[model samples]
Target: MRNKIITVCTAAVMLVMTASCGADKNMKKGEKFLAIGEYYEAAIQFKKAYGKTPPKERDKRGQRAAKLARCYDRMNSHQKAIAAYRNVIRYKQDTPETHAALARLLLKNGNYKEAAREFQTVLDTLKGNRLAENGLESALTAQRKKEEGSRYIVRKMDVFNSRRADFSPMFYGDEYDRLYFTSTRNEAEGDELSGITGTKNGDIFYSEKDDKGKWGKPQTIESGLNTEFDEGACCFTPDQREMYLTQCTSDPAYPRYATIVTSNRTDAAWSKATKLDITRDTLSSYAHPAISPDGEWLYFTSDMPGGKGGLDIWRVRITGAGLGGVENLGEPVNTAGDEMFPTFRPNGDLYFSSNGHPGMGGLDIFIASPDKKTGKFVLEHPGYPLNSQGDDFGMTFEGPHNRGFFSSNRGDGRGWDHIYSFEKPEIIQTVKGWVYEMEGYELPAAQVYMVGNDGTNLKLSVKGDGSFTQVVNPGTDYIMLATCKGFLNHKEEISIRQTDESEEHVLQFPLASIRVPVLIDNIFYDFDKYTLKPESATALDELVKLLEENPNVTIELSAHCDYRGSEAYNKKLSQKRAETVVEYLIAHGIAKDRLTPVGYGKEKPKTIRKKLTEAYPWLKEGDVLTEDFIKQLDKDKQEMCNQLNRRTEFIVLRTTYGMFDEKGNLKNPPKPAKEENKHDEDEIFDIFIE
Candidate 1:
């Protein structure tokens, strides 16, 4: 009887408390919900409060109006936020913060020019305000970038999308015909609605193209990875054998923390997931896993302590057995705001989304590439349509090209992310090369390393026949070095001019043996004049490269006359010609001490080499050329002999150019090689790199 009386008394007290709470209504409820990150619900309550308060209570009405505007901004309702903010200024006196807040929201909604005005107003009132100053700069930058247009044509993937939130798309399988993504629609497998997102728990879904290359309706992935919790933001190992995804579990006692889990693929089915072992004890939340192209590192987003702020990008090394310690990506990449959804191109460029960095208001995508010399990652904004004021993230690529899909919530007032396809049309540029012996077979196992001014350093692989192709962006200078165990290292410098037309560059590294003369092919001097023609620059520059490659070995730059001019005249002319070649070499950076100019003239007649004999079967390898001897041959043979006789060649006089000094440091280091002797016919190899 006492317990029943107490229960009735307690119930009456609760009823009274509820009545008192409802009486105060609007402002209190809105503030409470806003504190808990419930922007949608808070906006509704604040709007009600703004309507109820009379204009006579100017301070109270303006405060409610400002809160309502903030709520709308948080919910990504741009138009409503603008209207409410305008009401705040009209009802009560304006302040610098309110104008700044409105300006920030306007910039996020892509109203760049209007945002600039609001930011200017804030600056005018409150001088030297960092936020206002930065806001104006960002608004102006975004305005200019948008006006310039963008290469990407972004459009909603309507066929694969539902009315609910769908995002974080990734390619599945080697064929890449299958696409997997996350969704929180009503049809999701979870039995409970999430209090955090106010929707069904996130689940993984997949869609595939039909025979006609059109996507069908997406189907839920029933691999048990999705439970009565959130599961999304997945990545695959380079081998595609293991899948890593984010899982957020709920706890009634405390707020939930997300973790990364790995699932192995067994016969096309995903096995049960196991939580990844991270290094830090302070990582409160872990999600959004991205594996490096080499599969050696796993990068993820974390809200762990010691971060820049909010959330930051961190990585752990993936060894053959297990994982390694966690390390932050640090500065330029992570900011005081949230940085999430990290992805990688096959070439090691990192793409991630952040609100910490200056952007179009919300989370914008930025690319970070490592500096080859400094090893520091430099951040770059892809700009415009690739990023926006709404939450844009989860970028995935088709390959190295400028076409891919990313997620955005720009058009949604409720901030629901959806998949959108973007592509930039461009002319493909490439560099192709072959490594072979000067007079022998191809050097199939030669190692070729390349470093570019744009911070690209990679060890290039070759095909069975010693051919290699690498895709290069226009306007970048690249130095490529090819080395074989038995031969000297060959260096070439390639300068790719920016052009809209698709093109290819070819470089041939004809490595010479310790003993032999290498002909500088396609080299020519003017008829009766020793001047080098513009057409001969290509060949002469290649000769300079050969000298630089075999630095320690001094070379004799010999010029031979065709035995048509007087012996005395030929000797003087050939001597001048050899000196001209040597001067050109010195001018191009080859040390003068490494070269000896020799004019063979008519003194040493031409002898057919194996390559020449093979091309002209009637000719023998030891056939000597003199004026009388050439007259005995056929007309075609005489012209060919004369052509071969009037040539420039380099014979190795020594093998060591001072590779290292007594202290083991290089005395005369080779400069980064510049490419030469390129011909128009080499453009045929352009398609190989593509």
Candidate 2:
């Protein structure tokens, strides 16, 4: 099957002449050029031969068309190859190989339906055809893989692409500020064009970032590093003192086979490269070198003797200045189909492109993570748009981040590989909380004890504003306790939410102050009755927890009423309501002696707070809601003041309860239990206006 290269070309429609001599001569010349890998010249000869042959000679015309198509395929002229293959089929000269090549080209051009048919046609006869089977799977996967696309933001690196194929991006040096890649640009050393890509043979080129962080124009590496032959697909040692790369030397007498070579870095320039004696098998190709992060293994692609499949990833141990025996990575990393372009993230993840695995299309990239139990790599496909229905390979990461550049021919009609930058933004999650007195302002001196299910135990201090923000991991459960001197701890439990965007979770830590009475908001009761409403359970339960958090503290539950009611009636109602709250607290595990109920009636008025002024701009902070003060306001404002006055609250009586006895000796803790009490006062109560 044809590899990734030329696709589209301008059509040359010429009427075939009933010529004999010129057609035969041109066809033979085309065959010679095609055999020697002069695809550009081969295509020229075949096209002329196809045109000169008589139209009635369909077989001869088809042969020439198929030959031209093969050249176009190798040159990355995808569209032209597709058109030429159709001609070969229309003329009744199509073979299984021809159909397989057409299937690949059609798939790259997004004609999956037609490509599938072609693949099936070839696979029906050639049951062991790996290319056809892989192509069929790619066709189906390409249609369904998009919904599972990753969060990676991929963009073409236009500065790195050229008219010809430019691929295999590699980061250079410790700083990762320089980028090296293989390009077949016209400026490359070779005067002759590559029959493979219809451009000059590939050369190593590099670009460095300027002070402004923009990559400067790419420049060819000096002389000894590059030669007339194809030199690219390179990797550097951790120290960058040694370079390993692929080099393909051309010889018309035989087929060109790629071999790995090494070059030493002398000063700022690379010394002349020498072929690595990897194995005795001269018929095989060795290319695409990658150095492990630890610099202990040299991973490269080879069709060597012991490979599991076509072009499997193999590794040779780096022993000082020499290499050890090679080992195939083996299944499922190496499939029956071609697997190439193996690279690594700084974090030991092996990334390679393969058509053997179920993929979107062409060479879709896969990540091989080291399985903890077996230490063997387990494959994972990072779904679209990091991969697509075209040849996608050559991944290079910038350090440990989930971001970097890779090469792909996706969306390019010519099937030329171009560099693309991709990044999956980090899921930044943080928990922001404010620790403050329940009835007062922020507790700036408060300390928060934080614990998480993910082994995170930390003591965080609040800022001057009593707010603490800490970075948290996603999908992890966490609990925080905000504590300060003279204050009962406030416990908050949360989980970092699962979402696509970075998230900030807000928590409120309203610590119960041991000195002042803290208003218990959200406490509700039946209108005109002291009977507690069902909704009052939540507030009462929280109070129970607060008392439990400070086991040594005793509290007095005080209830008050607005001045609209009679003094005696209000007092009786407030007293009954306070008694109800105490009962609820006692039922929820607080000691009966630790809680005392009191009724202040209309004698105690509420004070306006800064928060109240926000909703009612007419009111000011620190304004006492006495009967006289509430009456002068608007009807809504007056009710709001009264609503604030009719409240239930608690004040800490002593922090030594159940801790020290009359003898001043520390006593054992007391077990909390409920006790029965009778209160037959009137059932009058206030609304839960707040």
Q: Can you write out model 1's per-residue Cα lDDT over 265-310, one digit (the tens) per residue? A: 8877887778886865633889999998756789999988888887
For candidate 2, the per-residue lDDT at 404 reads: 89
**Model 1 spans > 4 angstroms off:** 1-20, 23-74, 79-101, 117-132, 277-283, 429-690
Candidate 2 matches the true fold with a TM-score of 0.59
Worst lDDT window (10 residues) for model 2?
681-690
Q: Candidate 1 — which pairs collide?
A: 493-673, 493-674, 493-675, 552-656, 552-657, 553-654
Q: What TM-score should be assigned to candidate 1?
A: 0.57
Residue 473: error of model 1 in Å?
A: 7.8
Q: Put down candidate 2 lDDT per residue, 1-690, tens digits, no spaces.
A: 133222222122222233567888888888888777778888898898887877778888898899999999887788899999999999999999899889888877778899899999999999977767877988877878877677889999989888888999999855578999999998898698776666789999999998788998899987688988899999887656788999999887677789999999887789999999887889999999999876779898988777776789999888866888788999889987789999988667999999778777678899999986687888898998998888899999875567889999888877778999999887656788999877568887787877778866666656556876677878799878787888887777898767887777889999887776689999998997899999988888888877776777888999999998799999999999999999888888889999999999998787777756777788788888888898888898788888889899888898877767888877754334435332211111000000
Model 2 / residue 524 / CA error / Å: 67
TM-score of each: 0.57, 0.59
Q: Residue-pair clashes per candidate, as listed?
A: 6, 13
